[model samples]
Target: MASVPSLSASIQQRVADALGADPLLRRSDRADFQANGVLGLAKRNKANPREVAAQVVEALPTGDDDGLIAAIEVSGPGFLNITVSDAAITRTLAARAADDRLGVPLKADPGTTVVDYAQPNVAKEMHVGHLRSSVIGDAITKILEFEGEKVIRRHHIGDWGTQFGMLVQYLIEHPHELDHEAGETAAGEESMSRLDRVYKASRKLFDADEDFKTRSRKRVVDLQAGDPETLALWQRFVDESKIYFYSVYDKLDIAIRDEDIVGESGYNDMLIETCTLLEESGVAVRSNGALCVFFDDIKGKDGEPVPLIVQKADGGFGYAATDLSAIRNRTADLHADTLLYVVDARQALHFKMVFEAARRIGWLTDEVTVKHLPFGTVLGKDGKPLKTREGVSTKLEDLLDEAVQRAAVVIRAKNEELSEEVVAARAAEVGIGAIKYADLSTSLGRDYVFDLDRMVSLTGDTSVYLQYAYARIRSILRKAGDAKPAAHPELPLAPAERALGLLLDEFGNTLAGVAETYEPHKLASYLYSVASALATFYEQCPVLKADTPETVENRLFLADLTGRTLRQGMTLLGIRTPEQL
Candidate 1:
């Protein structure tokens, strides 16, 4: 409704009609566009593929309506090599610019999607794994929301569980352990970070003393049984952990509302009924005193069956049980039409079994789609999982702090006149954007190296590069003050303008593709293309110093439109574009 059908779609429709219902067109690499259905059609009707291709091409209109088709040629094996027209490219861009949503239409049938991500265990340090999950999930949520889907974010923080027992016991002994607020510069310097001190002291006592371990285990039982004293102590641990989590999320520039922090314990009530239903439906069985589901196809390296244990032998519910319960609540209570779990790829098998079990129990049905957007681990330069120099898990706060510092250097170098406060703020956005963009710019299923140098680099597929492109356009538009952007259909477009126009027109289609496939990398790649095209256009066409006033105004309009498109596209990827950087 916003613009005419894309050139690819229009051409496909023409070919489909020519082929009729007998044999349809197919994609071929031999041509820009190909129809391989001729081979199958020939086999069925005793016709040659080349002859069928020729007939289909002839049937395709060679008029103004088919303006996108500069030429339609038949290649070997009956492939249609169609070349699109420059005018068609310019027209689509102009039309897209005229619309409010930039030619991207909302889905007529949108569904409610509940995404569960950013799940960090309480009393434990937030690691790079949690950072990756939060960043990727944020981008996915943005893209889905842009597509008009009702997205409910679930930041399943590990605020509940038995680990709280050890933390609470330790906190009670060291009453002032969890005390802290924002630190001052030179006036206040602490020997240890608040979270570090608490975690270390708790871990030390838990490991060294047998009596402490016994008390911790007992504390867990008490906490589970709703013992008031133990529960109150547990709340302190959860609260302290939240302070640490919020500081990290704040640095990351991600919005994680407190109400969405549904920990595993939130599903405790439903876990019992979930297991009961699973056992009754034969989806799970008691094997070796533990409730589990074994698959014939999934096996260990020793050829033994790999069972998904829903409940431990100690009669305690595990992650599988918690997840199953969450699924039921999401579908029945939350009324979510879709459930998305953006967890690590290492848990793919676990999710696979859980989904199967849920399906068997009728919690997840055809009407409700469930997807596990499992992502790969982030590896260091050594090609192994990222870790600290001492081989410990890298703390997310430390990683983010380093990224922000590095970004400050880049911002200062580019904009020397900026105030310290502005530099810090812009640096945070650029730094966080770089980190997130590094993870999102690649296929989520593949492992990528966490290289700060490459991530914040000024050139090549980085967030800073895109930000610079957007800012540069803004600068040009600002210089051309009072010169409004207006499309001139009668005027012929330059090569750079045509190229930029073609890419801009495909924004809506690209968004739809990214949403349908649950692939943010596609959207990232598309934004990169847009920035690249705009750069080429800027280099070739002068916006503020064109030959004539009208020409300059039209070119400025083009630049303004490009800037808007870039800003919108980058925002969908959860990246911010600084006005001057």
Candidate 2:
């Protein structure tokens, strides 16, 4: 299929090139599209509005079969309510059906994008807090890649800091602490279990024994100083943590590679240099023995300036220092045109200051743009942050497992004869997709409630609904023996056929917008609208049992295209569509 230029875009360009002004075109509620730019253009040129609209209308290309614009009426001042011909819609869709891209165009000038997301801490279980970043970031990456953008995934896990000193020192004391049986080490869950036990024991000893605390603090200094022994011990913790991270990612069905697992410690070598550069450049000042970057507009509760501390007074580097160094590596070394930090919304101010500080140091300049794609917390049904009865954070694995379990029940009811293995397999797809769809259905900046009941339901905006819609279409096509889908643009179309065709024609335009804005929710909403229109079409227009063979084939063509569109869209969002119920 070839890339199809949208009807609105064609008209807008025609109007703009003719009048040499912005077209300001919008999809009309009552008409196909409305061009409201003539009113402004007329005022600017000191001409009559209706007369200017007439000139713009005359500029439109005229044709009977291939002409994009069918009717253009200039009414009420200078508003041009335009309608595209049904023939044109069918013709464009025919082109789309012939291409693998489904008529979506690759970016003319694609650039590198580094996405930082799915951060988890060392020697700890992943919680629901990390869910949004992983899901949203995966979708964004997929969407960007589909658009031909060079996407780099950075896990940015929490695999560094003074805490490692305690774990390492404890491991040193108990040399076989992290060592498991030959069979056990192969399992990620078993690896996590060993780490959790060691972590708890280390923390308990570090807190209770005075001498151990001194040894642990000294280990931190040794680790930072690059002592081979301490550094080697720290590496063990990092490697072990990745095992757990990979397991959780696998369960979620996200493909995370080992090479992309760059944590905070990845910037360790450059931290000191980063601080030195800031101080030398005078972007940072030594205040109370700490290197700090101050902003006039940023203040504390006492009306005093709150500076970003690059280094503590105790001669230790802070997160800001590590992040500044990361900017240099990502922008200068990676040659990334865009840097995206998919972090928590609470870190907005920290990123603002960090990015500003990076700009001051000339690391992030005109050639590169950075954005902290902040996301809100996932709340429970009670409208509070999700947590267990003991107030501990809900484990991400547990949440995912529950979703799959609930989906199995739904699948079982739909098909009682399904084997346990098949039911479980389909359940994972539906359950995982439900969680992802619900998260993406809402705007990235808004907090969303996590309700498995709503997410796994067969109706509404859930992914299950979309999945079933695709499956139903597949079923219809399978049942139509020897009835191949064939397009007939010359045949008169019912209103339902016309409506579905118009919506299908907008796929390229809709995806282009979503990819450009880095907003997956927009794509989700667009897909939902397409699915809804498809439902209406199916109900009103019979495919296999139509009165005539040509009409049946034409309706089947519409159904076939709709299924392909849904599958393509959902795949971009990291969701799977099963062929059966």
Q: Can you give the TM-score per candidate against the true fold? A: 0.90, 0.97
lDDT of 1 by residue, 131-167 (tens): 7789889988998998899999998877767777787
Candidate 1 global lDDT:
0.81
Using lDDT as the measure, the top candidate is: 2
Tens-digit lDDT track of model 2 for 1-581:
34667666777787689778987888886667888888888998899999988987787765563367777888899898887777777777777888888888898899999999999998999999999999999999999998899999998888888898898899899999777676554567887888999999999999999999999999999998899999898888888878888888888889999889888889999999999999999999999999999999999999999999999999998999989998999998999999999998999999999999999989999989799999999999999999999999999999999999999999999999999999999999999999999998889899999999999999999999999999999999999999988888777778888788878878888888887887899889988888888899988988899999988888888899999999999998889999987
Q: Cα miss at 106, model 2 (Å)?
A: 0.8
Worst 10 residues of 1 by lDDT: 184-193
